[model samples]
Target: MDEFAEARAALVTLEKRKQGLIAELNDVHAAIRSQRNKLEELIRRLPVSPINRLPDEILLRIFELILIFGTPRTEDKNCCVRWKGQLAEVSRQWRNVILHSPCLWTTIRVSPSWNTARIEAHIMRSSKSPLDIEISPWRNSYALKDRPLLRRLELVVPCAERWRSLTISSVVSSSTFRVLQRLDHLSLPSLTSVWIERFPCCEPGKFDLPFLQPQRAPLIEKIFISGDIGMLKGREIPSSVKTLAVESTSLRWKITSALLLEFVPCQRLTSLCLGNFTNSEELPPNSIQLPLLEKFVSRGGVSAALICAIVAPRLKHFECHELSAYPSLHDRFVAVGGKFSNVDHLELHAGPQRSQRYKPPSQSLRLAFPGRTQARFSTGNTLKA
Candidate 1:
């Protein structure tokens, strides 16, 4: 009887083990069914485009990058490329699309003074045909020396008349310059960008800046002037201009009440960058306001008091760089940096100063903090970086 009872107990243990294994198998099967059902629902909801089709807009936007990054220059005989690479790692499909699309390889950019014949060769070598060209004239070029490049550019670009977003800088004889007074003399309709850099910096009193009459391109919105700008009174800036960068090294600056009044026409302008404002004086008593001005950046001696005086109510951003007279102002006990009641952001460098070369220009010194004084800087965000 005892032997029969032990064998029966062993049989009961085997039955329990079989039941536990079956339960675990049932739980795994249910989990698999739940995952499969979720996957099927997701597959049904997903659109085919994300996996397969690319629209024309996306293709064009991808292709426009060639225009933006431009072509790369290389001396190796084995590597003739317009631009270096960037889009390759985006995806296999994009890499294939960019590689196959010639437009994505063609828009070539060369700095000024490049030999025109070589650029012509590069353009020819490109398997993908390009219609637009951007060239920076750092200096004149021999290859493009005689070509009707200005005219040819108009012909080659589809947006000619309205497509001229380029700058030309050359110090020509006073006689040749007379012919260029009307920027229309260039007569390329596609023009959009204008940069005029002149050497032997001229002042507004000596050289007349390039002028744009009332009916000039409706598209041109940015104008930058460097070198000597002749009396600006004769030239009427395009009324549509939204940005103006004007620089002059000459001390012939006249920041009188009348000059501030001249800023009225530029009310359409929102950004103004001025450099070399030489004098350490403020605006003449009551100057006209810069009604629409939002940002003002200057590079040289614009007085701390004068900036506060002239900057209108609408101004939002102000940056002053490389102040002219830290050495001259070091004799005073005043600080070297501070913010105006109006300005929210201010930057000042007590300019690595050593000693006073002359008397301080301002009655009070704001940016004059020295390391030994435990001085407090006025800029809320001031620290030596």
Candidate 2:
């Protein structure tokens, strides 16, 4: 019994010693943390290094440039959001610059797959700065369920008045774009540009997009649409728009002169691009007059009908691509060659072709332009003027 009692007392002593050692260890850790903090404070108080001596204005401008142009493709979409946080951690000076510049936080990219709280943080940090908002459809259409898509927009709709630009990309169906119908009532007073693109095969529903409506976004100046002509059906594009690019990249539809006249306020357009789809053969008896049109770009194929239809007296730059297959249009363009007499520069590019048969059309374009036009011809092989 005495021996057992001795063993228990020894165990108690060991336990007490362990507790004491643990308390001592904690004290040592606290002391180390205190010293580390003091070292950090001392380092901060030291004379700034030449590299860190850049003026705050210059540093802020550098940060803005980095935010605007530094997104690399390999990085995730949220890298910009991360950059603001990571840059702030570099030094107290950087943190102060980033926290004070609300414009740095105004480029918000919203996707159904991204976290809502992170988006909320960006909006909060932007304060009242005008926002460049992008509703990204990077995920497959199947992944963007109706509920989640609407939820994503719900966070942004309240900020509509501050929107400077809005890009809605890769929508694949009416159902996918239908969520935008929720925005029909919002007033986007500061919005100046809107770009919308749909997947190639989706139905081109007559979407009543709010930002392009005459009254909804009074200051809007540019509209770029990639997939559908019917996207302009319900809304009248405001006459304030100076640049209009309607590229029907899909084979399902062709942009017609009637359609262009119906939706686009042609007299106000200074730059027009008809892109990547087959040109319509049907034409009205009178050519469409674009009095102020200065730059015209037609891609994939430029048809004889279009060459005959558009009369741009102020045309300065004419850029046409994939002309190798359109030899017949070359002769037709020769018929209306006088229309572009004011054109200052003409660019003709023939995409990769099976044979050098592209050279004939390339030469024809050079000859087709009026004597005053400075022509550049490329057959995807050689560049000659």
Q: Please, what is the whole-model Cα lDDT of each candidate in the order they appear? A: 0.49, 0.75
Q: Provide the lDDT at 334 for model 2.
A: 65
lDDT of 2 by residue, 1-385 (tens): 9999999999999999999999999999999999999999999999988748999889989999887788886877678877888999999999999988888888887775567887797789899999988886535545555666667678988989999998877546454355466666788999999887762344445444677676778999898877655454444668899898877654445556446666777778899887765666686523678899999897866777777788888888989888745455467576675667778788877677725543445444545566444777677687767
Candidate 2 similarity to native, TM-score = 0.75
What tens digits encode model 1's per-residue C-alpha lDDT throughout 55-141?
A: 645765755655444334444221224332455456677666656665554444443333546556444544535233443332333
Please list the residue runs of candidate 1 whose C-alpha ends up more than 4 Å from where it truly belongs after superposition. Answer: 1-53, 63-133, 138-159, 169-184, 187-192, 199-211, 231-233, 250-264, 280-282, 326-342, 350-385
Query: Clashes in candidate 2: how many?
Result: 0
lDDT score of residue 205 within candidate 2: 53
* RMSD list, candidates in order: 17.5, 8.2
Error of 1 at 101 (Å): 9.1
Which candidate wins on lDDT?
Answer: 2
Worst lDDT 10-window in candidate 1: 369-378
